[model samples]
Target: MTFRPLLALLMALSVTVTASAQSAADLGASKPRKESTLPLLPTASEADAALISAHLLTRFHYDAQPLDDAMSQKIYTLYFKLLDGEKVFFTQQDMAKFAQDKDKFGNAIWNKDLSAPFDVFNQYVLRAIDRMNYARGLLKQGFDFNTNDTYNVDRKNADWPKDQAELNDLWRKRTMNDWLRLKLAGKSDDEIRKTLDKRYAGYIDRVKQLDSEDAFQTFMTAYANSTDPHTDYLGPREAENFDIQMKLSLEGIGAVLQARDDYTQIRELVPAGPASKSGKVHVGDLVLGVGQGATGPIVDVVGWRLDDVVNLIRGKKDTTVRLEIVPADQGQDGKHEMISLVRQKVAIEEQAAKKKVIEVTDGGVTRKIGVIELPMFYSDFGARSEGDKNFKSATRDVAKLLGELKAEGVQGVVMDLRNNGGGSLYEANELTGLFIDQGPVVQVRDARGQVQVQGDDDPGMAWSGPLAVLVNRGTASASEIFSAAIQDYSRGLVIGTPTFGKGTVQTLIDLDRFASDPTTKPNYGALKMTVQEFFRINGGSTQLRGVTPDISYPNNGDEKDFGESTYDNALPWTQIAPADYKPVADMKAYLTQLDQLHDARGAKSPAWQLMLDELAQYKKLSDRTTISLNFAQRETERKQLDALQADFRARHKAIDGADSAQADADAQLDDGLNPSERSLKTELKEQADAKKAPDPQLQETAHILFDAVGLINANPKLAAEVLPYGGKQGNSASMAAVAGATPLPTQNSAGQSGGASRAPAAASSSGH
Candidate 1:
């Protein structure tokens, strides 16, 4: 129901290797003394919004100068596209008013005066609401369900006249779907109409529940964003609530709340926390009834907004917020599981570094390999800077884990960086240092074109066993930087599909910090500015092109599903002059062989075929997003896709030996199948698992290392043939450092390079 495990779509943040940093100090700091980038808070400030916003514009700097007219207009379009709502969404009247009073907005947006920020923010919120209403209408009419990232293709219709046919038709269908849902749920047409009172009466009931407090609360975010991506404004109650949320300790069932249609949905339930511990309050479970204590009757709150529900749930320590939970899987008939729980703070520990040892026995030689998972590199600056010490960073924990693994005689290390969306830049630099001795790691060029190279300060390789880095479309930002460097330096094998193409950097500045803090409830906003681009040491930009085709391996990632290119306004990829570095053997010729081997295995594997089939089905459904209209048609299409997915999942489960005989018998009876099925049947796979000998990607990396070992063994002969001018100078200096930096000969418990772990479950659960 919820996926905090690895949300690649979480707000953007910078990775390591950029010179244009948020702090005044140089960008090369391995372990920063303080997190100077985020806006300092008097209280605990390492919250979601700050992290989310800072994640995006973390490396960029903000300038006071106004944007170019062209840029402003483009941003304007984007702003509307992203902000417009689908129910009670923005309407035609909203755009006309804005156009008529452009001067009013212009002054509010750009006036140098201090009052301008708050005034502009107020106006922005008002305008946003109007647009939001229209957007909601579009959603109700069955238009593309868009969010901040996935803006509807048809939303840019404000410039032209939009009638009810073109404008609200989509929203009407969505409303009809809701209407259908009510009808299916056993609500008679007469009963629903009588209960609703008017066509938009259902909307009105939700509107009153929305209220000024909630709307203003959202407005404050827009106001806070005007300054930078870190500083934020919170009303008296919200500030306290936010503080509780960040500490991972929360009262009232420890659930993240949000408005979903007419109900307040539980977004995230802290695993092992109060709600999760109870096991009664599952994610997506709705809290429609809250009682004071054990005996209080549960109140009907189906139509209540989020804040009201939260208020009802709030209580003193040990006091119960008797929650009437509607189990996620059930619709209106969802079981009411009353959970009586004490209000207590729950600490969030999910982000802590995790370590696992994979066993590989190769050629009868057994070796244990270590794998470490780090979700984010976070630092509590205020706590550490005050000399409290013991500040947490991914590098320190990983280094410690490496030492522990080395002590256990682990041979190779695979840095499982897939879905590592990135965090503290300081961790990226320090983490890079763990792998290699002091050398240039990455270069950063700012908007002004000032370039700076961030290098590794340490001079010793940390467990340099056969290193392999696992990455995919979700491995982004700092994760990308570290992986690219490892690949560039020939320090490790780059496995998995192409990474998330996010190479830009942003910086957050607190509007409140830049202005006077009003004694009478000061409001704060943050501005996230994209200022610089991160680059590889060899001058390759890790932007849209992202980390390039490294040892080709197959993954479930479809080329067009999701990536950097998914967005319309993403920056393009380009290259600069290559850095002065030793040349590594080209893997192109070997990659071809590896690709063929992988294709052979995947083609025959039913598990892989099922996944490929699912993709085909989703693609077909997505394609239907265009030209597909009407509530009935859309519902039918959705039901078909969902059914196909369910069938595919059942097929996959059957392959896993669940009702195996029955499933297999069913499959054998069917002869006319798609090309994908035929392909699977044709290629007999000896390698459904990576442990099989035919796995070429592993062979290539191993062969590269093996060849280097052979070179080291025949050093004298190599020097004689490859370099005639040798001995004390020239060619002696030309000798490659292969002997010094080869990855450790690690083995899994199975003891083979091929036996190294494949992150199938991790990849599947994390999607890409």
Candidate 2:
């Protein structure tokens, strides 16, 4: 209830502002001409918005860093990186020209002078057009992949081309690499040539479409992000999209998309959405083409804008949309697969918290453990305000599930917060209340250096048994709060990898509200600024260094490639005075024994070994920045990669005793089924898939929990100390305290912004 007013303030602030596969040869035959246009310039309104945003960020942002000449240089560098990050478009001469005004960016932004940024962007557009045109020409020359020449794939740190000739040579090698990838995928030389030609044409067309708003947004975003990664300037269209994402209801295939290089990549799938139900889509997968209906032509989509690609995938309810995607693990081998899905409104119920039971046996004794897979910290604010007693919320639903698990006589529980990008801050507080007695859950520090302790005032424990909180790199914001609270209280064993370090809290500011001219007509976009940072009850902040699990699993991803630490301007982790609360029990004493058992079991698990091997292979592949252009060499490498993948699959099948082919068949929906029957089939398929691939990390967590249960049972004193209400688990007095309490007031849907990991311009969810 303490957070309700803050939530209300945020809601009030928000109220103001608001495909196709083309076949290679036939599809690419015609060249799409680029429209000649004047240089894009910032409009009067955008300039005003930029000035207003600069004022707010400098005066109110949590970082509290002054925007002077030094800050100007940061914005300048960030702008160039965003414009031509790959270093394939601009030359060293272009950089030299841009460097002349590098120290003037801050002053220009403050003074509302937009000419410098616009001029730089115009130059970038021209360079991009020239590069694409040169690339198109190379397609006709036909590549000779027999040479041992290599192409560098990672050019972020590479030097810019010194001249036009050097730039041309870079394009030549890039064109050859593209051809080699398609050739490896079994496409003929003619098809590859046509595809490359069309791709470059699209690239040029996209560049030609850039307008004043796009330029303004990019420049302003660079200015904002220089303060902090989470801070951003959202244009009108983008502000609307952010609202939709928060609502979590869309009319597309239910996938969150982000642009990476020339491809639109799947960031995450909405639960129970068409894409997730189809089971063919996955995170990190690159979408290549989109088609309408089952038989529509698959239009080439490479080099298209993120929003354009999203529009292509979204359609009316029940309409079929097809996608051609390169699997995430395939890594530019050029292999692709087509998947068809029906468009529908993503159901909120599908994204709600769900429960299942996994049985863990150790020393011939089996223990039933409840696993609650929470996708996000969600709540229906609208339903709650209307006095709907059963309004949905993470804490409410999880409470009911805990009662059910209790009835089933489970011994322990594993809270699976993996990939939960975070949501409602109120729900996070109440959810922590479910596991611990009344106490501070997290501390919030404002830009003014004022600290506020947010905690659950509610008096009962939902579950007092041995518990383990499972997390990964995707867990962030509110998720980090709950995990850190549990760890601080020693109420549960935090398992899995370090979380996504997003401790900063952001709020949307309507720029139009602050404009001095009333006649401006509200076209000024909003600024999402960081106003606060989160600290755990133990006084440590979860900013750049997320909660490190008490027991860490082997991580497969590079820490540098993911999480808040990836941002150069991210706020540093800090601390505050520790909150006054007693930990249920110190988990450190039992960690050594538990770890020994875990390592021993993993040593004997073929699946675990396989995961390690795959991680090693991934590391090896990730380290390579160049690829040989020799056709024979590339063919042999491709064969070796294929053989390795085949071996991994075969070993996995042997371990799980599930045929991959059969699993695929089970996932497909039969066209003859009625609507109700189709729904039933989908549900059955989801269950079958879950059974087919049991989560190794989760299974291991369950084992760890069982081990904790055993340890507690062996030590009566420890058991007594661990139990809630002084050895009385879920006592009648605690239950009565909660039963008579007033219902929690509903908070605004935008109380705490989620997923600080991405900039608004880069991420989008398709549909309304």
Pairs that collide in candidate 2 are 19-290, 19-299, 20-290, 20-298, 20-299, 21-298, 21-299, 22-298
Tens-digit lDDT track for model 2 on 1-768? Answer: 000111122122211111111111222312221243668777788888988888898888888778899999999888877777778887888788779999998778778889999998888778878888988887887978778799998886899899778888888998888888778878787977877786677567667756676678778878887887778888865665554445444466877676554667776677788888888998768888888788988888776655556656756677788899999888656699999988886645556789998887778988778899888876655455676565556776787777677666677889999988777666777788788766888888888899988786655566767789999998888899999999999888999999888887777677889878777665688887778887899999888888999999988767767788887777787888999888876777678889998999899988788778878988888878898989999889888887777677767678766575345344432222212222323544656675666468998998898887787767866665554544464544222222222222212112211221211221111110
The TM-scores of all predictions, comma-separated, are: 0.60, 0.76
Candidate 2 at 118: error in angstroms?
2.0
The global C-alpha lDDT for each of the candidates, from Candidate 1 onward, is 0.47, 0.72
- Alpha-carbon shift of residue 87 in model 2 (angstroms): 0.9
Q: Candidate 2: where is the Cα deviation over 4 Å?
A: 1-37, 250-351, 362-364, 379-392, 407-409, 517-521, 661-694, 713-715, 729-768
Q: lDDT by residue for model 1 over 297-396, one digit each (tens)?
A: 6766665544445666665556666777787778657767777876664444566567776554434544455677776544443333565335444565
Q: Which stretches of candidate 1 lie over 4 Å from their true place?
A: 1-72, 85-97, 102-104, 111-161, 165-168, 177-347, 356-371, 403-411, 517-521, 552-596, 626-647, 659-768
Q: Whole-model lDDT for model 2 versus the true structure?
A: 0.72
